[model samples]
Target: MKKKRPSLQDVANQVGVTKMTISRYLRDTSQVSTALRSKIAIALDKLGYIPNRAPEILSNATSKAIGVLLPSLTNQVFAEVLRGIESVTDSHGYQTMLAHYGYSSEREEFRLASLLSYNIDGLILSERLHTERTLKMIEVAGIPVVEIMDSSSPCIDLAVGFNNHDAAYQITKEILKSGHSKPVYLGARHDERTIIRLQGYEQAMREFGLEPRNICTDRPSSYSLGCELLKEALRRYPDTDSIFCTNDDIAIGAAFECQRQKLRIPNDMAIAGFHGHDIGQSMEPKLTSVLTPREEIGKVAAQRLLARLRGETVTPKILDLGFTLLYGDSI
Candidate 1:
């Protein structure tokens, strides 16, 4: 009922070469003469032969593939990070497999299991907070792991990210120095990073002897949610002079809401956000944000994994890439 796939021997016979010669040619073209190489290539094309990699995989135990786990695809920040990863992986002749878990540790565990079943060489994870089962599974896999985006939690193997708490603290202090004491924190998702950023904001407010207000949501960060949070913040704390959002999405949303309310930037209400997302700068009153090195984190994480795979030593398991605060029209 189905057509059989052509084998290596079939192509070898058609090319008038021994099976071993065909095998050597397939592995390395440089091993064969130019005329023989051309003949083998022609035979492969004529017979529609596909080289079976199962035997090589059985001997090497490597799929020549790396697994990357992401939280949400909607977040535009990962685009740059993925680009950096591909820049390294492609050059090294390794492929990447991506999986998303919507920021859930349980879903992440399942995805990790699936990736492991394929015998991936290494893994790149976005979150540091993993379930106990996930941790055990990663330990058993015995593959190189690199965690990115949050450096607050203890890492499994290697960590490449910035200190989210310190970044938030520095930005919040800057807002305070700009003469906006009545500051409120706006956040969403309430993930690990969200909590850390909140802690930084709270610490800054407490150090300055200013009472902090937090208006947050359990939903994922979005422009719409930002507007709702800002609306609620204004209603509860009518004198809310400054608002620090968890990410750029919420900050942009808050900026739009401020415009609808006819509020002047920094004078009536100052808005600042985390992550130097492009839309932040495109705004009429450009958003002030904490710029995390997202792309460098991805690039460095891939490099470390590749080094481990190549049997090279990777020093300093933990890496803090650092962050920058970009001041703009919106304080």
Candidate 2:
């Protein structure tokens, strides 16, 4: 009889490394060093073993990886967020795993537990208070946790994000100063971040004695869909002069719709966004938004996790990296 195929376990047996490290090499995650990669390559060649690429990593041996849970990947903003998370995770020799929750709390809860089943080293969560069960799970996940973009909640482990309440308050206040009272909020979900941003907008509008207009939180994939939503908003609330998207991607889409309507940006209708991105800047009128320290967040989150892995003390003081407001033509 012919010899059987060598498994990841067989390779691990030969290489003196974890099966998870072998999977990291197979996935091309850049978490392993060249020496280990070469060793794995030699093992594969010698044993004629192939990696299984089905249904993600199957066990905790494979799950010792770094898991990044997010709303979606189509958005460039999220891509940057991933870059930030990966940049640090890579530097520390941890493989990166990914899961998309589709901006749903229940979905996040499911994926969170699924990723945890793998016994990942740490987790980077995009939204907070997504679901009741997710909160419960976080309370006992027993690993390093980092919440990005919205850090209002009492995160169990680590947090590297902005004060959405303050960011929304400041941006809304600027819009009020520029003479626009009826600004609709565009967002993907009504999670903790969205609630805070909406609250801040309401707080500012009330401070200026302006009744907050209709809060239409429409979630869409592309420009055409956003255009339709904005068109309806324009018809329903014609006095609405400015638009504030929860993130820069939505703002860019809203701007496209504004362009299609033949509206001069910042003149006929001013537009602003949050999470300043290069895509936002590449537009005709550079997006006036908040530049969340993405790279810094990633680097810092990684450092924090590494410190914990190294048994160092981390506190809330240094973890508070704030946000900066960027003003532009659409102000």
Best by TM-score: 1
Query: Per-residue lDDT of 1-331 in model 2, one digit per residue for the tens?
Result: 9667788999988888999888878778488997887887888888889655344544334344777898877866677777877787777677787999887778899999998777777788877565777777766767777777655667656787778898998998988798776777665555567678888888888999887764455364455545665777788888788877777766788888888788988877777788888788888898889888877777777677767766788887336678989988787
Candidate 2, clashing residue pairs? Answer: none
Question: Model 1, clash count?
Answer: 0
**Residue-pair clashes per candidate:** 0, 0
**RMSD to the hidden true structure, all candidates:** 2.5, 5.7
What's the lDDT for residue 43 in model 1?
89
Question: Which digits, one per residue and each the tens of the lDDT, describe model 1 over residues 21-78?
Answer: 9999987899999999999988899998877767766776688899999998888778
Task: Report the poorest 10 consecutive residues by lDDT, candidate 2.
Answer: 53-62
Query: What is the Cα-based TM-score of model 1?
Result: 0.91
Candidate 2 — what's its lDDT? Answer: 0.76
What is the model-wide C-alpha lDDT for candidate 1? 0.90
lDDT of 2 at 24: 77
TM-score of 2: 0.79
